[model samples]
Target: MARGPYEAAIPAKIADVDPQIDSRTQSLVEAATVEMVRFDAELGRDSAPFAALLLRSESASSSEIENLTAGARKVLLAQLGDRSSVNASLIASNVSAMQAAIGLSEDLSVENIGTMHHALLVSTDQGIAGEYRDRQVWIRGNSPHSAEFVPPHHGRVMDAMKDLVAFMRRDDIPALTQAALAHAQFETIHPFADGNGRTGRAIVSALLRAKNVTERVTIPVSSGLLTNTRLYFEALGAYREGNVAPIVELFAESAILAVDHGRLLAADIESALRDYRERLGATQESVRKILELLPREPAITAEMAADSTGVSTATAYRAVQRLEEVGILSPAGKIRGVRVWVAADIIAALDDFAARAGRRSRH
Candidate 1:
C-alpha cells in the first residue's frame, strides 16, 4: 500500500523538552501538587472507598471522551456482577485498565503501557490488546486524506514509544510537567490501533502515582478534562503544533479541579457512612464489615457480601436485610433470582461527581 504524504509529517522522535517553566506556571503546578498531596494524606492508608470512587470517575469520564456513556447506577451494578449492557462493560474495562495502570506505575515502560491498553480492550477487542498498530491509523475522519491527524507509521511506533519512555525517566522536570508531556506525547504517537485516548489518560493517573504527586488515590483529572472536551482536544492539537504550554497548563488546572472535587466526594462518603452507623445503632460484625466494604463496593449481592466480608451466606443475607431496613442498602433488582442491593446514597454521590466533573467549564 502506498503511504500518504502526511506520513512524512508524523513525529517519529520525542522532541527535547525544556523542563523549565516561568514562575507563574511553576506556581500553578506547585499549587496543584500541594492539593493532590493534601487530598492523599487526608485519605490515609485505608483509602479504598475514595480510591474506588476516583478510579470509577476517571474511567467513566475517559470513556466518555470516546463517546462511550454509562450511568453511575449501571456501572456500579455492573461492577457488582449484575447483568451489564455493552456500554457498562466498556466502562468496566476502563476501570480494569485504570487499576492496571496504577499497579504498573512503579515501572513505567512501553511494555506496561501495552499492558494497560490490553487490559482496557481485552474484553471488547482482544486482537488489539497489548499490541502496537501494525497498519496506518487516522483520527476524526473516514480516511487519512481527510483525517484531523495521522499518527506516525507503525514502523516508527516503537522508536517513538522508546523515546517517550526515555523522556518519562528524566528527574529534572516537575512531576506534573513530565506527566503532561508524557500524555501528550503518547497521544501523538498513537501507538495502538485503538484505545489511545483512554490509554493515554490512564498514563496520567499512573504518572501521578509514579512521581509521588499522589500517594493513595488516583485523582480524577479526566473528570476535569471532561469539563471541556473541545478544549482538551485543542490542547492536544496545540501540543502537536510544538506549543506544549497549553497541555501543561491544562493538566495543572485539571489536577487542581480533580483534587477539589475529590475532597468533596470523600467528605460526602464519610457523612453517609456515619449516618448509616447511627441508624444501624452499633451494628454487628457482619454489618460493620459491610459498611466498610460499601465505599469500595457500593452495590453487591448476598454472595458478593459473603465473599468480601468473609461471612457465611446466611450471615451476609441477614446483614443485607438489616442494611435494607436502615435505608442504607436498597434493592436494585435481581439477577437470576439472586437479589442485589445498592447503597443508593453512594451511587447518587458518584453520579453527581461524574456529572459535576463533566460539566462544561466556564473558564
Candidate 2:
C-alpha cells in the first residue's frame, strides 16, 4: 500500500533561530563539529583497510549486539583492524536485520521487522533478544529519579507507522523533509521492546538514502545523538505530541553537520593519496601494478601477487606485507595457510559510501 504525508499530533512550525545562541551550548556544538570534522578527515583518508575490517566486523557484531558487552565490543573492534577473509556470511548476517527492517530485500514476503528481534538478539546475545512483551508496557526512560509517563496506545502508533512508510516512499515531499518526518514517526512508534534506538538510527540512514539527501556518506548521526541523550529524547517526546518542528530541525541540523564532517574527511583522504603517490616516485611502478591487480582480484595471495606483479613469490609477499604494515592491506584471518591479503578498510568504506549514495538516490 502507498503511504502519504505524516501528520503531527499537533500542528507545529519551525522555530526561528535565536541570534542569542552566542551562548555556551552553541559554542560547544561548534567546537564538537570542528573536532568531528578533523577526526573524520583523518580517519577517512586512511580508513580503507580499517573501515573494511570494522564494517565487516560491524556486520558480524550487529548480529550479536544483544549479547556483546562493552568489553566484547572493544575486543571485537580491536581484533578487526588487521584481519581479512573475515567470513562474508557473518558480515551479511549482521546487516540482514537492518536490510529486512528497511524492506531492502527482493523477498518482501519473508517477514516483518518484528521477526528481526531474534536475529538482533542472537547477534547480541542479550536475553531480551527475540522476545516481545506479552502485555502492554509503559515506555519509560532508565534515568535515575524520573517518574515515567505511560501514554495510551489506541492503535494510533501502528497507523502512524504505515502512514510513515508511505510518506517515505512518496515522490511529493522534499527529500529532506520526508527523511526527517520518517525518522520522527518511527521513533514515535517505539514498536520494539528493546533496540528501538539503534533501529531508529538505522532507519534514519535508510530514509536518507531513500530520499537522496546524502550521497556517499554514512552520516553516523547516532554518534551525534549520543552526545545529548536527554535532548534527543526530549525532542523525540515533543514529536509525539504532534510537534514536528523540533525533530525536523534537529535532523536537518544533524544532516548538515554530518555532511560538513564528510567533506572535510574526503579532502583529507585526497591529500593523503597525493602525498603517498609522491613518495613512491619511480617505484611507483609497483603501485601501478598493484592497482591493476586490485580490481580484478582485490584479495591477494602470495602466489597471486607474484603472478600479478611478475615478481618472485618472496618479493611479492614482501611488497604486500609492506602495504599491510603501512595500513593499506591486512590478512583476512589467522588460519595462515593460503592466507589472503585484502584492502579491506578502503573497500569497505567505498562500499559504505556507495550504499549511502544508493539510499540517498532512492529519494
Candidate 3:
C-alpha cells in the first residue's frame, strides 16, 4: 500500500528563513518600523486599554481565535480585578495547551492536553463548534483517488501534538523562522480532530507572544490568511512536499503586510484620541470635574456638571454635549433633564479596531 500525500505530510526539518534584505522588502519593513515607532510614542499612554479592547474585538469574530482570546483575557482581567463571576477556565485550559503544544514551556503535561481538548469538544457542544473526526480526515476534492479519505490512526492525533510541542520548545533556532515552520508542522500533524486551523493560528500568536516577536501586541495574521485562503492552503501543500521556503516567505510577507496595516490603524486611533482631547480644552476641565461627580451618581443632570464645574447650566450642558459629540460619553436615555453619560470612547475604539480588522479579513 502506498501512502502518497499522507505519508509525505509532515516536515522533518525547520524552514530556513534568511534575513536577506532586498531593497523593496527592506523598504516595506522600514516604513512599517517608522510608523510603528511613531504610533507607539503617540499612543503609549493608552496602549494597555487599547490593546485589551482590540484583542477582544479581533478574536471574537472567529470561534477558535475567540477561545484563546477569552483565555488570555481571563488571565489578564483576573490580575486587574476580581473575575470570580467572569469565569473562563476552559478557555484558559485550551490556551495553556496551545502554549504547551507550541513549546512555550519545557513539557506538555497531561493536564494541558486535557484542557485544550476539553475546550475544543465543549466549544463544539455550544453550537457547531469545530469538532474532531475519529477517523483519518482528508481535504475534500483534493485527493485524486477519491473525493475524501481518512487515515487509519486519527484518534492518536494528540500524540502528534506532543511532538509538535517538543519541536516548538526547541531553542536552537530563530523565533520568526520557528514560528513559520511550527505553523506548517502543526498543520501537517493535524493534531486535533477539529479546530486545527484556528488552533494553529492561536499557536502562532502564542509563540509570537512567548518569543517577544510581537512584544505585548497581537498581529491579526488570520485576517491576512483568510483574505487568500487558496494561497494559505497552497503554502501548506508546498510544505507537505518538503519545500519550506515558499511558506516561510509567505509568512514573512504576510507579517510585513499586517504590521504595515496595523500601523495605519494605530495612527487613525491616535489621531482620533488626540482630536477628542484637544476639543475638550477648558471645557474638558469642566467635564473632568463632572466625571468626578458622576461616580457618586452616574445618572446625573447636565446641571450637575455645571454645579461641579462652577459654570452656568447652559455651559455644563454644552460641555456634556461636546463629550457626547466625540463619543466620550453617551446619554443614558431619551430623558430630558437627568441624563446619564457613560464612557463611550473605549467602545468606539474597539469598534474601529473591529472594522479595520474585518476589512483586512476581506482583503
Instruction: Identify the leading candidate in terms of lDDT.
Output: 1
Q: Please list the C-alpha lDDT of all candidates, in the order they appear.
A: 0.87, 0.47, 0.52
The ten-residue window of minimal lDDT in model 3 covers 73-82
Q: Write one digit per residue (lDDT tens) for candidate 3, span 97-140.
A: 34343443223333453344444445334442343445565545
Question: What is the C-alpha lDDT profile of model 1 across 227-315, one tens digit per residue?
Answer: 88888899999888888788888889988888878888888889988888889987699989988899898888999999988999999
Q: Residue by residue across 1-363, what tens digits does model 2's lDDT show?
A: 324432223212222211122244344444544543444355554455333332332333332323321222222322333233233333343444554444442221113444554454455445656454333334544421232533324345444445555555666654445555666665555555566555555566555545544332345454334334455567778766766566655555555545543444345434444554554455545555664454334466767778868888877777777666566666765334566666554444334432332222111
Compared with the true structure, the alpha-carbon lDDT of candidate 3 equals 0.52
TM-score of 2: 0.54
- Candidate 1 accuracy as lDDT: 0.87
Q: Per-residue error at 336 for model 1, in Å? A: 5.4
TM-score of 3: 0.58
Better of 1 and 3 by TM-score: 1
Clashes of 2: 28
User: Which candidate gets the maximum TM-score versus the true structure?
Assistant: 1
Ranking by lDDT: 1, 3, 2
Greater lDDT among 1 and 2 belongs to 1
TM, every model: 0.95, 0.54, 0.58
